[model samples]
Target: MSTWMVTGGAGYIGSHVVEAFRAQGIGVVVVDDLSSGHEAFVPADVPFVRTDVQDREAVAAALDEHRVQGVVHLAGFKYAGVSVTRPLHTYTQNVTGTVALLQAMADAGTTDIVFSSSAAVYGTPTVDLVTETTPTLPESPYGESKLVGEWLLRDQARALEGTSTPLRHTSLRYFNVVGSGHDHLYDTSPHNLFPLVLDALVQGRTPTVFGTDYPTPDGTCVRDYVHVADLATSHVAAARALEGGHDLAPVYNLGSGDGVSVRQIMSAVASVTGTPFTPQEAPRRPGDPARIVASGELAARDLDWQMRHTLEQMVESAWRARQAAEAATP
Candidate 1:
């Protein structure tokens, strides 16, 4: 079995990717700083290195020790709004950290990688359905950092081109990842809508909806809310494709061709949690786009991407995992 290193394998999405890799009979080694990832989330059998991706030496050592053939790079500062104020931190974590990882990979001779990119790369896109060809006009520093990371990969591939073993890489862009793949693994992002709403409901507080007067059918923001498990499957697929020397595009969007509105999400949450509290209404957030959905045609063609879970399934699975996490918390 080939071993792949997951940079943030202890976090929610990373943990799911680790699980998916394992299910495919692929070995996985995890390197995480525990900044936002929990050690418990990593399986006991998997080797876990407690270090940040910025620590080039540690990452390289882990790669060498594990005989890692490739990497699923997922560690970074992911909050777009926070990145606006903490641009330096975001750049350091996302851009500089990626640079260090790439350098380490080059030094250790591990070339294949599947980057955890984001739809933020196309900030407030004018097109209703974004494709891989959509022009990247990142708005926040976080989005900019992700775009820079993709550039780093492209440049590295170029630099290593025509070599005996050139770098092979692909980046997966996604939006609004929700739900839980494992009972112990749940989204812990304080800024994410699913977790925020679930956390509020768990704490007996009413959730708030930012806007309800968008140009959409329901007058609420519509987004491509793909389930985390479905997202993880694509990551594993990309890794396998790279391992098999299959050529892939530089980037692909793992998205729902159609999308769900915030109102629809709230209704699903209510039905799943058995909580019937009306969400508090608030003015639209500045720079908030009314609708942003991406077509997963490329991902489906290359990575076996599919929307296996319905909106209700996503909500219920997420709620169950949230409840499990809360119960486990001391």
Candidate 2:
């Protein structure tokens, strides 16, 4: 079995990846400081180390001890608005943490990596579907940090001499990631729309729609929300490809293939739960794009990836998981 190290395996996306790997009978280890992620979310069988990715020594030791063949780096602050408000923290976590992780990987002879990037790097795209070749003009610190991380990975690979070991990296730029796990681990992100809507609905409250006068047909911000399970599968595929000697720094975009508006999301939730719902409209938030969908054709063709869940399936699954968690609570 191939051994892998997941940097933020306790977080939402990381945990999903961890479960996916374990389900495939692969050996996995996790390193997370639990600053934002929960320990309860991590699988019980997989080995875990509670430590910061910035701690070079700790990360290196984990890699070596686990004999990690590759890494999936997913630990970083992801809130776009918060990143704009706190640029320094965003840089430190996304950029500095990546540097530290790369150094540790180098020290441990772990050269293959699957990076978690974002479509925010595309900023305000002129077209509805953004291709990987689109100009990167990140509008927020979070986006800038991710783009810089991508550059760092490429540069690190390019700088390797013939005698030195090569670093192969795949950066998967994902749009908004949503949905819930079978275990129903409460994801702690206050920015993502899916969980926020689920939270508000469970409390018998009206969900907030930040922008209702957007240029889209629904008059609300539209985004491509890919299910977390499909996203996790993409990471697994990328890792396997790199391990099989794919001599390229493959960059792929993960999306739902279409856009979903805030109003439509509310409608989906209401339909799933069989409840009449209305959203509270608020002024448009900064950095809010009218529509942001990705061209996942490359990912599908190269990685053999396909989004299996429909929009209704995503909402219903999330609702079921959230309700189960609430019912299980004392």
Give the CA lDDT, 0 to 100, for residue 77 in model 2: 90
Off by over 4 Å in 1: none
- Tell me the tens digit of each residue's lDDT in model 2 across 29-122: 9999998898888878889899989999999998898889999999999888788889999999999999999998888888889999999898
lDDT of 1 by residue, 117-232 (tens): 99888988889899999999888888889999999999999999998768999999979899987888999898888998999999999999988898899888899999999999
Clashing pairs in 2: none
lDDT of 2: 0.86
Q: Which residue pairs in candidate 1 collide?
A: none
Q: What's the lDDT for residue 301 in model 2? A: 77
Top candidate when judged by lDDT against the true structure? 1
Error of 2 at 274 (Å): 1.3
The CA lDDT at 129 in model 2 is 83
Q: Which residue window of length 10 is worst by lDDT in model 1?
A: 283-292
